[model samples]
Structure formats: C-alpha cells, structure tokens
Target: MATLESFLKDAAQGDLVPWSSQVLAAQRFDLSLATVEGTILYLDLLPARYQRNRNMISIKQQRRLFNSHAVVIGCGGLGGYVLEQLARLGVGRITAVDPDTFEEHNLNRQLLSSPRLLGHAKVEVAASRITDINPAVTVVPVLAAFGEDNGVEIVAGADVVVDAVDNVPARFALANICGAAGIPLVHGAIAGWYGHVATQYPGDTTLQKIYSRFKNGKGVESELGNPSFTPGVAASFQVAEACKVLIEEGDALRHRKLHLNLLDMEVVDVPF
Candidate 1:
C-alpha cells in the first residue's frame, strides 16, 4: 500500500504540486481532497493555489496553516471578507459562526450578501463560497450565534478566532470564551468610513479596555452606517493578524490597534 505522503512527494514538480496531481492523488488513495492537500504540505510541497504565497509564506508555515483550525465568530460584514481571505490564503479548517439570514441592509457592506441571497443564512452562504474558492479548506458552518451556550464548543481546538460580531456584548462574550480556552482573538470593527483591527490573547484585557465604554451598544456602526469598503479594509487587517497567529510569525496586533480612516485614506496606530 502506497502512503499518501510518498505519493505526494513523488508527484511534486520541484517544491510545487499542481492541483491536478493533488486531485489524482486523492482519488487514487480514496481520501478527501483536503487530506491529500494536507499530505502535500506535510511533504513540503506547495499546492498550486498557494504558489504565489511563496517567498512570503514558507513551506513550514504553509504546513502549519494546512493543519490549523480557525473560528470566525461572525459571518456578516467583517466575517464574510475574513472567511474569504482565510480560505484563499489556505487555512485548512474554518468554522464560520453567524446566525442571521441576509437582509437588504447587509448588501451595503457584507461581502457574501447579494440580492439573490437575501434571506439566506450567512454561514451556509459563507461555507459554500469558501468551498468554491478552496476545496482543500474545510468549512464548518455553524448556524448559531456565538454565546455562552456554544462559544466554548464552537472554538474548541482553534488556533485563533476572529471577532466580527456586531454587538459589544457579543464581542465581550467571545473574548471571555477565547480567554478561557487560551485561544487568540483577532478583533475587527467597522463604522461608516472607519474601522480598527486588534488582537487579544488569552489572559489579556485588551478587548475589555477597548469596549468598556460602549456598554450594551453595538458600537458606532449604527450612527456611521458603514460604507461598502470599511469591512473589507478592517477584515484585511484581521485576516493578516489571524494568519500571523496561526503561522506563529510576524508582529501580530497584540496589545495594539491598527485604526483605519478610509474616508481620508489614513492609518493610525492606537496603542493600548
């Protein structure tokens, strides 16, 4: 019986494995495509989809991403973009958590929302989109809100979590759960032409310090009424931070916030 790793190593073309070879290997071994892709990474062969990620992401980091599990706590504005980037960037497993169905209002800033998808559940749509983008990535669409009832179980084994929920209380709930679970949380928020990205590690009180004044409100997004570009900008930063955590590389946004004013095309560092 030929082993999966041996097959992938033999099928590689100078440190890169084409997608066709990956597909053939999966079929030959009776394995899921994701399993085959993981084996390719384990053997230090870059998948064709991630060929461009080379020189920035090394073979070791790509393998780490293939084996990583990430949880995105909201599938609305920020989360939709976060999920999109994570899958494209080759995170192997993702858990998308969002309970709401898309509505007309979401069309303004939500990446996965469309006139055709109105009233469709966000997580399901997200899962389908992720699959369409990267079949090697497994998406677990949880059609439930992130709260005490399911937060711990939802984030179990995650290398990192992204905060894309709309409300301040929900953000705190997610932060608390991640703190208890020893998982890092990449926090992102958007308000009109503004957005911010920060990272919170377990035992850190950064999120508490940031949202303490908001109380029960969902932040200034209600007043600002986010523009279409804000979530994309914020999610870009969030995804980069999340990737840093997963790869255990780079200067992650821990204890500091990267604030953006797209209205003026300016970036400001807000340190905590």
Candidate 2:
C-alpha cells in the first residue's frame, strides 16, 4: 500500500490540479489504460497526495456525500459550526438561510463573523467563509425567514436538513419541511447550561414530540441568557450526527435525543 505522504512527495515533483479525470483516477490508485490516458493529459492537474487522501476516501462513500445536498436553516451559533464542519467534510452543496445580520455579541461563538463583519448579513458572511474553507463546495445563501412560504422549496433540494435556528416556530417549520421532503432533520437547541439534539426523520421521532416538554412554558426570550459554551457543545454534536446521517455511516440519534449539562459535565442519550 502506497502511503499518502510518499505519494505526495512524488507528485510534488510535478504540477497538479483537482477534479481532472487523471487526478481522480490516480487518486483512486487505478492505473488502467483509461486512467493512464487521463493522467497523461492532465497529470499537472492532480491534487496533492494529501488532499487526495483527505478527499477521496472509499470512492463509494465519497460519491454518496459528493452527490448530496444539505440545508442549514440558521447561520448563528449552531448553524455556523454545522456549516463549517459540513464544508470541511466535503459535502457537495450547502444552502444556508438566515435573516439576521451579524452583531458584536455574535463574536463570542459565531465562526463566520468577525469585527469587520458586524452589521453584514449572516448568510453572506457564512457563504464567504464556506467558500474560503472549501472552494469546491457549492454554497447557496438565502437571506429570508424559513416559514410556510419558503419551507418547501428550501427543503426540497436537500438530502439532509439541519435545524440550528434559535426559535421554536422556525425549528418546527424546518422539521415539518424535512418530514414533507422525507429527509432526515438533525435538530439542536440551547439554553443556558442545557442543550439538546436529536435526529428526526419522517415517520420517526418528530421535533414536536421532543419539544413537547417545553410547549406549556414560556421559553427563554433573551439570547443573552444562553451561555457561550452551550451552543458550541450542542452544535458540535448536531454536526456530527448530521454527517453520520449524510454518509450512512454508524448509528445516528434517530428516534432518540441527547441531553447535555455543561454545568455538571454530563450527557444522557434518551430513547424518544
């Protein structure tokens, strides 16, 4: 087995680019006549060996994710982390929707915003950051509210949907869209030291059921009440589960919910 490091050292002796058939075949370690011809013509376009290894893992799995589309309904605390992770993992296309603009307070956890981005649209900031992270990723930014009017179209084109939005109405709307689309929706919510995440698919655990416990009470109003670390931890888990669902890898949190208590440093996975 040729190691990626050695192959990169050898390839570095020449020019290389990505996505060319030659680079694709060579990265796959296939030296057939077809691959040979492609390589001969575009050998200078091959991706560096490290990138090849990082990007091309089990051609079947890579193709599955590369052909999939994901929609993230919030580009705030959780959505920012989810978008960044998904882009890095090589998800083919991403649609980011958010109606808010970056503010000074967001600098605490929002990865896409900086001092310069204050007052700029969240989707624009996230789209630019996503492009910088992975130019190959196709990012669509929609600066609109995810409601009944746009929910169907927003969820229709996605293979998977992520609910990182802050409010209940938006989360419920996205969940409904995912259910209607028959796609899996990875859901996450944060408040103070507590946070929760779940994977809900049509005909499976719905966000309505998971959030039933809080319907009777008035939810937290001030975003300021949410501590900095809460969204980070919850968003990380949400992104992980979303990737698992996208890749069809290990078991996901479908039909189950995960609760985290940062104050006590505890986690519990409960069957829904």
Candidate 3:
C-alpha cells in the first residue's frame, strides 16, 4: 500500500500539487480531495491554486489555513465578497448566515447577486458559489437572521467571525456573540466610497465604542449607499485580517481602525 504522501510527491509538479494530482490521490486512496489536499500541505507541498500564496504564506501556514474555519455573518455585499475570497484562499470550512434573499437592489454591488438569483436566499447562493469556487472547501449555509437565539450557535467552533452586517444593531449583536464564544471577529463595513476594518478579540469593547455612537438603528450607509467597489475593497481587507488571525502571524487590526476613503484617495490606520 503506497502512502498518500508518496503518491502526492510523485504526482506533484515540483512542490505544487495540481488539481489533477489531488483528484488522482483521492480516487486511489478512497479519500476526499480535501483529505488529499491536507496530506499534501502537511507534507510541505503547496496546492497549485495556492501557489501564489507561497513565500508570504509558507506550506505550514497554508496547511493551517486548510484546517481553519471562518464564519461570515451576513452574506450580502461584504459577506459575498468575503466568502468568495475565503473559499478561493482555501479556508477549508465556511459558515454563511443571512436572513434575506437577493433583491434587485443587490445587483449594483454584490458579487453573488445576479438577475436570475434575485429571489434566491443569500446564504444558499453563497454556499453554491463557494462550492463552485473551491470544491475542496466546505460551505455551511444558514438561511436565518443572526439574533440572540441563534448568534452563539451560528458562530460556534469558528476560528474567526467576520462582521459583514450592514446595520449597527447587528454589528453590536455579532460583537457580543463573538465575545461570548471568545472568537476573534474581523469587522468590516462599507458605505459609498468610505469604509472601515477592525478586529475585535474576546473582551474587546471596540464594537461598543464604534456602534454605540451610531444610533437610529443603522449607520451612514442608509444615506450614502454602497457602490460596487467599496465592498470589494472592504472585504479584501477583512479577509486579510481574518487570514492573519487564522495563521497566527502578523499584526492584526486590533485596538485600531483601518479607515478608507476611496473618493478622497486616502487610507488611514487610526489607533484607538
């Protein structure tokens, strides 16, 4: 019986494991492609898709990513882009939660939103989209709002939670939920060309300070409106922070806020 590692080594093109090689290994060993992927990474071989993630992310860190799970609350604009990036980044497992279905208004900004998906549930679409983007990654779609009853359960066992909710109230609730679970939350919000990204570790009161000041149930987005570019930029930053949190490397955006104003051509990292 040949070891899985031996088969992977033989199939690999240099240090990179091609998708064909992963499929072959899974077929031979009667294992899942994810299992084969993990084996290759554990053996210090990089999957071809993640070859660009090398140098910056070592084989060990890539494997760490493969073992990590991130829960994204709200599969809307920020959540949509975040889920896409996380799946493509090989996060292994993702939980996408959202209560609403895709609306006509979503087409302007949401990556997953299309004319045919207008009436479809966001989380369901998110799950399908993630799987289509990365077959080896698992997508757990929860088609429900995040509230007191389901917040904790929604985020359970997640390595990190991303705040993509469009409202201030939901952000506060999500922060409390993450606090209770002791899971780090990568917070992101976008309105027009202005957006911000921050990290809230367990016991961090940053969300209170950030959201308490904004009453009226929602943030400035109600008036300004999110354009197509903001969510992509904001989600990109959020994924970067989440990746850092999962890999246990680099300085996370804790105790500080990364504020961006594309309209003004400025990106300021403000310490709180």
**Candidate 1 structure quality by residue, lDDT tens digits, 114-212:** 999999999999999999989999999999988888888999999999999988888888999999999999999888888888999998988888887
Query: What are the lDDT figures for the candidates, one per model?
Result: 0.90, 0.75, 0.90
Q: Which model is ahead, 1 or 2, in terms of lDDT?
A: 1
The digit string of per-residue lDDT tens for model 2 on 1-272 reads 65433443354435443334334445466554223333332333333322553353444554456567999999998898899988877677899999999998888778787999899999998899988876656789999989978899888878889998888877777777778789899999888788899998787755888767766433663543675678788888987887778778778887778888888998998888
Give each model a TM-score: 0.96, 0.79, 0.96
User: Cα RMSDs of all predictions?
Assistant: 1.4, 7.1, 1.3
lDDT of 3 by residue, 1-272 (tens): 88898989988899998998898888989998888888988888888999888879888888999999999998999999999999998899899999999999999999999999999999999999988878888889998888878898889999999999877777888999899899999999888999999999999977778765675766678899899999999999999999999999899999989999999999998876
Q: What pairs collide in candidate 1?
A: none
User: After superposition, which runs of candidate 1 have C-alpha atoms over 4 Å from their true positions?
Assistant: 1-3
